[model samples]
Target: MAHYERDLTGNVDDLVAHLDRAIPQGSISAKYEAGSDHRVGDARMLVRAYERYSALGGNRVSLCISVLAVGEEMSLSMVSAGGSEAVFFKVNTFGEEAFLERAIQALESYPG
Candidate 1:
């Protein structure tokens, strides 16, 4: 698990830009649900919108994001792709919107 905490400042776009800057290529796989149930592009978009909303509030933010690689026979195989990678963002006390945005950005941008 990797952790990041900061006095939040910036919009979703800013966070996305930050993510683009922070994460390297070939790190993150496609975004999926918590249980790895679905492939929803709109879910990713919602996270982006939340990040933008949090940026306007200047809230204290903290996050724990992790990357995992799982094989085909795993229990959480719904989203797994026969040794695919997954990223998880866990937030605490931060602006919900901001935290979610950062999480999504981190998920999308992280280098596996």
Candidate 2:
């Protein structure tokens, strides 16, 4: 699993927008993990999981992206999975850097 922590300087709206845009293309599922029950940044904490496919046509892996708020800032956490089960027992490892680069970059560059 890969992990990253960033100090984000922005309001909830700006943070949400940045997170929303950084998500990779795939069918995603999200839910509140803490704080308020609302769907937006009001939740204070959110977890998203999505499927990733390999080019060689094998088992798909499930990766997770978690967002949480601390005081006046927010942070993103990403975890990678190795599809080592059944057909994916010997499959190639996924490159998590490619998946998270955009999101991390967005956070570092976001002005607000």
Candidate 3:
């Protein structure tokens, strides 16, 4: 598995929409599996799950993105998993890491 986290300032809705567009555009096999947005008092949260074909692993891998915002501050977390093919211990993590690179590129390219 691979993980990434960041804290920044932006409109939650806009950030979510940006990621919604950016993540899936990285590769032809990338896709948005599901997503959710929720609000509580002055805070908001968004979670999105995506899948992409991992050529190295010969399988599909998952990427999960979670965002939380309150006022003008936002926190983002992303995790990539499911590419390992070991029967027990983990192996072949390159596919997972490559999948995560998509999210990193999208976040770095965010206009905010």
- The number of the candidate with the highest TM-score is 3
Candidate 1 per-residue C-alpha lDDT over 26-48 given as tens digits, one digit per residue, 9 for 90 to 100: 12322322222222442222121
Model 2: what TM-score?
0.55
TM-score of 3: 0.96
Pairs of residues clashing in candidate 1: 12-52, 27-111, 27-112, 50-97
lDDT tens per residue, model 3, 1-112? 9999999998888888988899999989999999998999999899999999999899889999999999889999999999989889788888789879989999889897
Model 2 residue 45 CA deviation in Å: 1.6
The residue pairs in collision within model 3 are none
**Against the hidden reference, what TM-scores do the models get?**
0.25, 0.55, 0.96
Q: Comparing candidate 1 with candidate 3, which one achieves the higher lDDT?
A: 3
By lDDT, who's the top model here? 3
* Order of candidate numbers by lDDT, starting with the best: 3, 2, 1
Worst 10 residues of 3 by lDDT: 87-96
- Model 1, position 26: C-alpha lDDT score: 17
Q: After superposition, how far is residue 56 of candidate 3 from its true place, in Å?
A: 0.7
Report the lDDT of model 3 for residue 45: 90
In model 3, the runs with Cα more than 4 Å from the true position are none
